[model samples]
Target: MPMRLFNIVYITILCLFSTFVIGQTLEILPPKNITTVQVFNPQKNDNTAIIRLGSNEYLLFLFDDLEAGYKRYNYKIEHRNADWSESNIFESEYVVGLNNDYVRTYKNSFNTYKKFTNYQIQFPNKDMNVKLGGNYLLKVYTTNEDQPIFTKRFAVYQGNVDVGMKSSRYINPTYKDINQRIQTVISSGSQNLTETPDGGKLFIMKNNNWNEHIADINPDFTRSNQLTYNNVEWTFEGGGEYNWFDTKNLDVPGLTTERNFRKDSVYHTVLRVDFPKYNLPYDDYGDVNGNFYIRNNRFGNEYLAASEADYSWVYFALDAFEDQNGLYEPYVVGAFNNWEISPQSKLKYNPVSKLWENEYFLKQGYYNYQYVVVNTKNKRVEPSYVSGSFWQTENLYQGLFYYRPWGGRYDILMGYGEVNTRN
Candidate 1:
């Protein structure tokens, strides 16, 4: 194993074990009732992004080469509910594919012969597929094509991490036996290694990236035997004292992040949104992500969510927001939006708003999210998530991660941060 590979495995194990996604291939499964066509992978561009949420893994992918388009391009995920299949987003409850809500379909494509990326969309609900943490296949079909197209089976894993980490190295008659019980995880736990109680040392191997995050190393404490052997880098997640090397690693509070930079600064308009409880029937009457969105175009005391781990979504209705001519679709823009806007992540129009609105599910951390409109052709866009509203509401945020090392049990670690209006 290479050092980086060990780091990834260690960190992967330290973070969480997802047996479902590990090394699983995408394949075509059947027993179905939908029209199909020629489906295959070019071996190279068969790119896929698998996400593990809770106990389930969601795959977001795109496919290409459609001869034509249709009024309704309905797709279905076919699978069976068995005795050991764990759980399904829809299973063992009632009839399958009962309605559109359980299924996600795209109607009327702007389909063209031009090269398009992110062309595939799949919502592999637990029913159409099993959550057994293994590899499965995907079959593609079209209202136009005839035979079901076969795909390479991709792996979906549900592996988690180990916990039970206590102190390491105890040499003495009193706490020697006691220390061994904490997590005598290493292959070697001989007494010769322990020179003294405080001097005696024990070690825990963490995956690369599985780091000393949130908590910093105690300055007064020193680190020995911190080196690499074989392909693995053996070090500590950090310890000694409590708050030694702590200055908010990875992410600070009230901050935002994005993969693409669509614009410069995303406008965030904070609102006093009351999620209709009893008397209310819908959302965003004053909702930002709502259809009947209150159109405010300013910034506010917008600090962070009450919880530190909230990256807000920016929703805006599109009503001639811009010229509908471009390679990119306009989605609500914000710092989370990465500033760029066009078609890939654009918002759909809502008749109720009499405008168009887009929604984004942000990372569970801090930062202001705002409404942004973009023109893919000109590449011009505007953001305003922070705007006008009589009601003032701010958000505080927190982050928590659970993980276990490979071959060992696991535990959960909760980290907190405060991201206000400050950078």
Candidate 2:
């Protein structure tokens, strides 16, 4: 097998093994009715769920359950090593106080068609705080549940170094107009830090996607207190601005919303069919940058009860032609799925309808989504197949710096920085 293909298979096998091993500690099985899941730094709108260690910082996590009833939810944190495997450490070694706490704040949806309970909690709060700087996973579960309802991966980093990242047009002539390049530099003020050529690792992500991140990146060069990494592999297709539709008001549909009608038990809404954009020029517009927010306009107030909101079967349709490659499988990707490619988001091609379609049981809110084509052979996802790539498209890129001390068992996030293509 080719070296690249071989590496992919090897990594897949390793991941399966990790699943078998880590499954004992990390049990994440969210129900299908959960929606609008978000985890990020509350202070900064563009910040990821990464915070500085020992600082008065917190990571906010929120989600909505469409069950229409009250349920006790609690959370706990687990420390992980550089490779995301559960670290062999006791809870008291990293946690300062209580390791788990109940989610005291929840509200039922009110004055809306869908009824769901909104649940939110923040980490490093009164009951608990992290002591170690490494990778961490926050697991949310209900009372007496054997498995967690969901899990969000977050990081607590020690700001030991300064990171600088920038985005520009790709230098490769063929991909110049369609792709953008990323460059990173890490600098430390302390002279004690020495370069560990093979120990340093860098990860880059577009938007807030973790599954589609660019990993296994190493620094190209290292000086006394500086590291630089720039490569052609860091170039990413400038996916077109995300297509969005607002379902804030169940009674009225907007430009992107085709129509909405009530069904047997829930409402059904169909979004306008999206055609191939490869033939058209890029159009610049403001978007959530592929992120989504839960909004229920039917509720006159910002605070809402979980039960007052209603549910809808939102249908997303894409125009497809017979000439399209059969090997490519398209999946609807957005914050709704954590931007991860999964079977739940996979699209089905209907020859009779001449369209690719996927239906989601979503809450009444504003959402952003894009169709991405997954190459079955290599398991790589490309967004240009449905949403055309262009240089003008606005994109967000984030860089994370992981440092592991000598004899250290885990990686410490030393620096982080983000840049935009349009900046």
Candidate 3:
């Protein structure tokens, strides 16, 4: 090839690589001052950020900034493919109105030792409305510098197809006792999924954890307008039920709280020490399936909890023998931290106390969490290593079906369904 032609191709490849890198790294970093970020449907009072396409309902995004004062923050919405990657379609093709807008609603904390400001915004507002039904990313940033502080993922579905899900523990012998398999069937009605060059894709998620999900799953067979997915790969660890703690009332110690006290003009809470359940028999204590909710029991009105609740430095300690050898690192995982294993969630071993301890500044609420071990050599996270896997453990499984024609620019969310293992 000519020198000029070679140079042009090289530059094009470099630009494409740069764009891909930026897209991949955008969701990893979040500002340190941001805390308790939540996106959910207010009407349902749950943490799942899913809504029906063209419905009157909306998802509310809420967060607290430790900076304690008002700051100008803007949010931009971007449509994503079924794999959570940037779609090729333009913003106008997926968004009905403005793609970006300022967050106009905020409130200051009242009667709290730690002063902070809470910010919230509702989707499908006056300035912006999503036109497409698929995966979406909400990017929150500072308006002045255009610097992104955090990003969240949500979904909208047309419900054009019906999805049926069944979860069982009768997998192969190797995983039959420790894994739960999800079998799904999608009814496409008059739509023929096989007509497209690439048929529909299925994604399964456990307990609404986006970071750990099974994606790009194809159907095993299709017939009579029905697609089935019963592959052996559709299995997840049946990790034990989450450990919980309640801090809805600072004056009174909750079930899992060892004690609550005040020091240095601030509040602190010590949770009861936790232990590894790998050797213990399965216990069926009902839980919220690794989810959390903010509430102040002292206040009669539940709505006031958002602004009136106080912050406390909650201490967590683990008395596990597996991590004593230092082969693995232990970190507390839950919805409170967006289910991401970060430095904030890592626990440090105390030589004198012989325990792994960490403290988190959290608002008054009820939280569900579990201890996870990270292999030092391979960096593999094992949820069942400390929590103990059980075939009888209850779990929530969700499935999403996406379809796109051969020439379509983006994937369409055709069906969504969820099932509880023992419900």
Candidate 4:
């Protein structure tokens, strides 16, 4: 057999016999009772889960169980490659302490109509610590079950390299007004990166949405110790700012909320009807770029709000009669659902009202969302179909650099950086 084909077959067998095979995509697989899964850096006050290695920084993982009772939940951490596949290295090589352990922090909801038990865990604790800087996955599961309730992705970087990025209008004339391009440069300070053709990889994501990203991009130019990525294909849709509404207080309606009422002993918030922005000019009203944080305006303490905040049924209506043909399906997407399309977020057409409507049971917080369409034939998600695209739209772009020396067992996260279009 050829050398390359033999190596490929060997790797496939190794992955199959491994403890677990993380698929190509990073995703969350929560059951029906799970909601509001969030992983973020508490100190940074943002949803991005990238942290520096060997620093005091930690990533916070929070989720709520609608079952409303305490349960014995355990978590396990696994190292992954830049492509999100299981790494070839052993757990002991990547983790300094126990890789699997129990979650000791939880709280029951207080003074809320909807009953729930919130579970939280912080990483790099005494029980568990990651020694290697690379992609990692946190899997939460029942004490006795091998199947995970949900899995989340986070990254650790060594900061050994300096990564810089700049954004501008796309070079293509046809997409110049509707798309934005990013150019990246990585300076390897002291690390000796392999000079092989396939030794390094770069990934770029927009607005911290891992579901949609550009991956496996090689540097367009290489210098003494610097790599540059100026490819024209590194362009993303400059979708308009996310539509936002506040639900910090259940008793009082917030801006963009049409009404708030008590129904079935629970609060219900109806947002004003929305319209397509394809033809409308860009509106830079400022938004969190499709992120949300739990808050209860009635309380003075944030931690108190975490447990005291109530859940409500939020109603959304989009009047897109012109775009509501049988060829496309509309979905309301945001960070609440990890920006993934699910059955609950899919809007149904109401013939009587001539609108697309859907409702989500969400915790008390301010949220940003937008309407997107899926092409029926191609199963492609088009954010610009309903939200519109413009070069002036502000966006947060993140760049990650990964390196794997020749004959290395796994990839190492050497550098991480962010760039904002409005900056």
Candidate 5:
């Protein structure tokens, strides 16, 4: 086999195996009874939870459970290495307090149909504090079971280094409409710090989606405590703005919703089939950066899923001229599924309607989604074709710097920063 083909095959195998292992171990979510899971830095409205070590910043974890009352939910923190696998350090070694803590903050939903309890927890609290700065996973489960029902990954960085990044037009003319380039510079704040080009790892992600992450990026050069990464490899497809629909109320259809009705006490919604006009001029309206906001219109300022949400079967349709053939398959990508492309988000082509159709049982809320084409041949996903790409499209970009010395046991999150296309 050709070297490039062999490498692609190897990476595909590794990704598949890694996904399988994570499905069995991490189990980021349970089968049912949970909804609207969000873990973010309270300081920002976006889904970024990466925070500075020992800072006042905290990660807020919230989820809704389908119950009128509370369940004995508890959480435990685990340390992770650069690969997101369990680190060699024990729980006691990283946590200053107890490893397990009960979720004491919860509220019952107010006036909505599907009763539920909203559970929330703020990390690095008085009872539990982080002692190590690196990757950490928050595992939540019932008190009776040892297995976790769900897990959230977050990072704590020491900020020992500085990160500066810029977004610009891609140099390649062939991809000018479809790609945007990012150039980054990292410099150590202290003179004693040293980062070898091979020992340092750079991770770049778009819109806070973990699955959309670019990992193991190497720098172009190193000078003392400074490193620069500038290459076409840093370019990402400038996916178009998200398509949104609000189902905040079952009685009324939201924008972009074609129709909504109730049958046999079950709610149904049909979204207007999207036919993106790529030739049209680029128009920039603000968006949630491909995130979903769970709320019911029945109660103002109350986003509690238990009393505020109504479950409904939302049918989505994409007007496509022909069946996606050869290497690429289409999927509905959004925060609903952690922006992960899977069978659940895959769309089926309907020949009679000439559209790609899919349905998801979603809670009543405002949702932002986009159509993404997945290249089956190389396991690469791109939204540029399905959704028009534009340089002006607002996007959140994150830069994570990981460093490990010659004899260090694990990679430390030395620095983290965010830049955007708008600013």
Candidate 6:
């Protein structure tokens, strides 16, 4: 990364003040529940990690990089003046665990398809702690001599979930909104996909809620696209919850094991984003005047799962009313940005009402996103993506744990991620 880029990210961390708290960062969070993963190297010693306002529980992490092995990290929030300084409350080195024998086979050109042998590395049993305040960091390394391989940033609330008790913030993170749909539904499809020699083939709702081009995606890198819905007014409220249900709730065996503790499993609303249908069908497949997505990484634990690759794609539509330059504006946000609405994906404003429009092509699966206004006053936000929700891809989120430490049962959450819509 360039010095300027690093500087820009840290600068934004300082500026992330949330209406709910002292401040916040808008980055995608990691999957809250993951049991199995393949890390590249772990035999070596001296892997250190750092934290800002540390916690008293197990590690709070963004889903690690599958390619590079976990620890690519999120900046989160601002504290102690919001600078990366020591007083900022959070910052430190980390002790990360790795599963070395995660690969199934090595398909080298030499006709050697060897199963990745198990190196017998172990996961941690205790919670990692960084006892301070303000914004902090976690840096994990192989050894003092090795370069820091994995990095994560988090904010310590010093409080609990019971604190935010209004507008569904405690349970769902997003609350009332102008564009919120009276009712919304979402589901997932598959993760292990076979790419056609021609293109990708992701399954989505029969309706045009997703992109036709998405069927052709087969990338190592992924992105989180919000699931559109109603009653979601995420205009700078520091932190919130986003719950994505698994498809098993729809009753497809072997696809999922999640059962609703309550009969209404689909009633759970996690994230939202714009759908292709928002625009009249005349637009080009590669055009959007304004649109974007947002994330919650600045705060603790909130992250983009599976490295933003295997998750749902976030889509937004800019104002067609904007000028020809509308497509050139910002239409996306979330943890991907440093938190602020970015110019790189801005919505090009229409000359009619001078409103802008934009769109995003995200990965398939489920997610939570905010429909922002972009301007400082956040005056340009849209509610269609917020309130007018839709259902797209249907993927299964399976959580398996090696509880015995060596060879325990792989416990998948019963009603953990079953995605569905309300009756």
Quality of model 6 by C-alpha lDDT = 0.24
lDDT of 3 by residue, 187-299 (tens): 97677877885658887788887655677676888875789998766677788999999988898999899999989878899999999898899999989889888888878
The model with the greater TM-score, 3 or 5, is: 3
lDDT of 5 by residue, 114-233 (tens): 567888888889999887778888889886446788887788998888888898876556555546778899988573345443778777888877656567776787777888989665
Error of 1 at 390 (Å): 59
TM-score of 1: 0.23
Q: Sort all candidates by lDDT, best to worst.
A: 4, 3, 5, 2, 1, 6
- TM-scores, one per candidate: 0.23, 0.87, 0.92, 0.92, 0.87, 0.31
**How much lDDT does each candidate structure score?**
0.26, 0.72, 0.79, 0.81, 0.74, 0.24
lDDT of 1 at 385: 15
Candidate 4: regions farther than 4 A off: 1-26, 176-178
How would you encode candidate 1's per-residue C-alpha lDDT over 1-423 as one tens digit per residue?
112212232222212211112223222322112111112122311122222323434554333222334323334432211111222333323224422222133332222112111133443454454433322334354442234343322333332311123323223343211111112221122222122223222222221111111221111222232111111122221111100011111232122122222223332322222111212221222211110111111211111111121222333343444333544343543222222233434666567755555554332222233343333443333221112211111211111222222332212121111221111
Per-residue accuracy of model 4 over 1-423 as CA lDDT, tens digit each:
112111122122223221224454335468868888888687898899899999999988988899999998999888888978888688889898787888898999999999999988999898899888899989898864357788888999989999999999764565543478889999986765547657788888888877556777778888758899997767787889999999998888898999999988899999999999888988888899999888899875556777789999999999954554577878898888776665767899898988899998999998999998766655556777787888889999999899987778889998999999988
Off by over 4 Å in 5: 1-24, 67-69, 143-146, 174-178, 191-197, 276-280, 298-307, 350-354
Clashes of 6: 124
Local accuracy of candidate 2 as per-residue lDDT tens digits, 1-423: 223211132233223221212445442536777776777565774337788898888877878887868888888888887657777788888898988788887888765566678887878888889888778888887774347777877888777887799998765564543468789998888833454545666777778665545667777777778888876566677878999988877778867999988878678889999887877888887887887665577564333523455678899998853234677778887877665566677788887887888998877777889887766666555667777878788988888777777777667777778898878
Worst 10 residues of 6 by lDDT: 396-405
The better-scoring model by lDDT among 5 and 6 is 5
On TM-score, who's better, 3 or 6?
3
Who wins the lDDT comparison?
A: 4
TM-score of 6: 0.31
Give residue 175's lDDT in candidate 5 (0 to 100).
53
| Candidate 1: Cα lDDT at 301 | 15
